[model samples]
Target: MNAPARIADFVINSNADDLAQQITLLAGQINAATHRLLKLIAEFDTCKGWSGGGTVRTCAHWLNWQCGIALGAAREKVRVAHRLEELPLIDAAFEKGEISYSKVRAMTRVATAENEDYLLMIARHGTASHMEKLVGKFDRVQRQRTDRQHDKEQENARKLVYYQNDDGMWVIHAKLPPEAGEQVIKALEAVVAPIQEERQRELQESCSTDAHGDVSAETFSATVEHEKRESGNHFQELLEHTRADALVKITEHFLATSAGGTSLQALKGAERCQIMLHVDIDTLQRNGSTHAPNPHCREFEHQQWLSPDTARRLSCDASLVTLCRYHHRLLHQGSFSIEAVRDEGHDSPALRFISAAGATIETSFFPQFPGVSAETSPLALQRLAPDVDATTSCPYWTGEHMDYGMAVDGLLRRTQ
Candidate 1:
């Protein structure tokens, strides 16, 4: 009988456990022999020893035509064969049948002379999946290091440039730091999420609703298919429109809020967004001194510069008010509030802006009082003082008679 027939007869007669053990042993032997064969093919290809000599463009192509192997398998074999030359430990492990080809394949992608020993140890003890995961982590770490190095080299090149085009439209090109760029992207995506969700809900409801109540199965199937296609096309258009709308919302949100509060406040540390503007002490006291030049202040929110008069107008209405950050969040959830402080005599009150907890002082005032005209509402003074008698005329009171009694009556009614 032939050797194969003899082996088949033995395998057919053997017990289950023995057959299983023998099969595993034979598989390892086949794997080891395959590596040896690949190494020999690599050596022959290196010397141009094929039938066509050096005429073949690649060893993989030569193997595919001559050995009847698939192109993908031949290419893989040729790659591993070359890698084996540089990886002595892995090559030895393969020959000894201590590791599988799957493990060795993953190692070769990231293995270098410096890391070969560590990689070989992992291949010897770990499963093929474990080896793949290790290789992936190694690749990610290497890529992150490379990215940081590239960013450092390009640090000085970061800038924002603008120019007016021929059509009279302004074009802005910005090169921001990686972290800042990521934050901008995240903010835009956050804004787009709800918009996409709302559109999807509307589409789902519209697609499922049928005016004709009852329908045949065939008709129902056709309607569903048509609706699916229609919804898909509408979804694409919705995505495009949502992105544009989100950008506009982000711009408006940033401009309407001051330094202490921004729409993007959730994405950044409160301290990072806190802007401090230095003014002359005399100007702050209204002594007619010119405001100091604040070089630290830069244009924000569409790059619009704040004029001196505008800055002065904003400062005059600024006030210190205390509220918890959670309360601030609730207010923003319901409606936005302008930060304001209660002006007290020259003793800068014990209020320092706190951003640690959600509690902080806002420097702008809310314009929600009655009797304040829309034109002068923003400029009206607010008093939270306890000693101020109700009989005194309130600066905020704007009624026909400007009398103390009228002011007292309005204050009591508003409080009640």
Candidate 2:
């Protein structure tokens, strides 16, 4: 019989009270042997290419084909074996059967020369799962530190730039701090709320009407309930349309009010918005001399660029207000405002521009004229009339009407 058959026969026939103890010793011996075998594999792999026997490309590949081991297991063994060379303490523990290969593998991932001693102690006393958890926590902390550093770099690089495209459309590019970006997103969503609700109501009404134009309340109710249930799934869809609408609202608000010389305080309760513009005193007088060549002549809201003519128009009646930052350690002068909007659950509220005296200046500033689109051109304001009536107009209007031109002229005089 072969030596293997002899050992099998001996193992089967042997009967003693110490058999279990002997099996335990055998297990330790096998573990120690495995440590030595891995070291030899590592050395053979390192020198394989020089011998022209490296057709398998890698030691792990050779092991997979020659020993019939799974590629994943072979690769893991190769990795651990190579790492063990740099981890003398861990290699010693493995060779002495004080720690299993599973524990060693997890340790080597996050272990460095500085922490290897502490990690080896843990591997000797703790279970494999415990070792794995420690490694995971270490990796997470390291990643967080790296992320904070990256965010700081990004904040330092934050900027806003604008230029006119070939088609005469203004293009704006902005980089903002994470918190500031979040605030802007929230503000945009708030502005888009009524528009979204109006669209939803129209959709429900259309669904409720049949071919004969007879409305069904039951169908409308069902549609409303269904929409509410699926609203979360449609956040991405709503955000896209809402973003476009918000941009239009912002541009219209700035051009209509700021260009016409309205003060920040005057727009209070009308809309919660702010804009900054930089213009030279010379430019505002429409002098033939130009500062367009100097970059300092044009910067708005810290990042946007304005053409000299546009800057001149906006600065006509601009006033400076002091702003506090960083716990009052710094103070600077600029135009800004804080305004509040009335909250009406499930109902679209009317939008009105209000003055400091709490009188409404313009009603339905967003929807504008009946035939005019929300995306109307800035120049279109000359042709379209304001949507003012008894129901839509503010209580302060009192039957007298102010056209866009008259309103702009009034704002200019008030600011001056």
**TM-scores for every candidate against the unseen true structure:** 0.34, 0.35
Model 2: per-residue Cα lDDT over 1-416, one tens digit each: 99999998777777542565445444444445567768988898787731222123478766765555688899888888899999888787677655667778898886666677777765555566666776766555555668886677668878898997878787878889898888877878877888878876777667755665555678777876777678966856766767788878866677667754656333544334555654433344444434344343222324444555677566545654322343122211111122445445413233343333354433111322446554634233212212211221111223343243442233234323
- On TM-score, the candidate that comes out on top is 2
lDDT of 2: 0.59
Report the lDDT of model 2 for residue 124.
56
Question: What are the candidates' C-alpha RMSDs?
Answer: 37.3, 34.2
TM value for model 2: 0.35
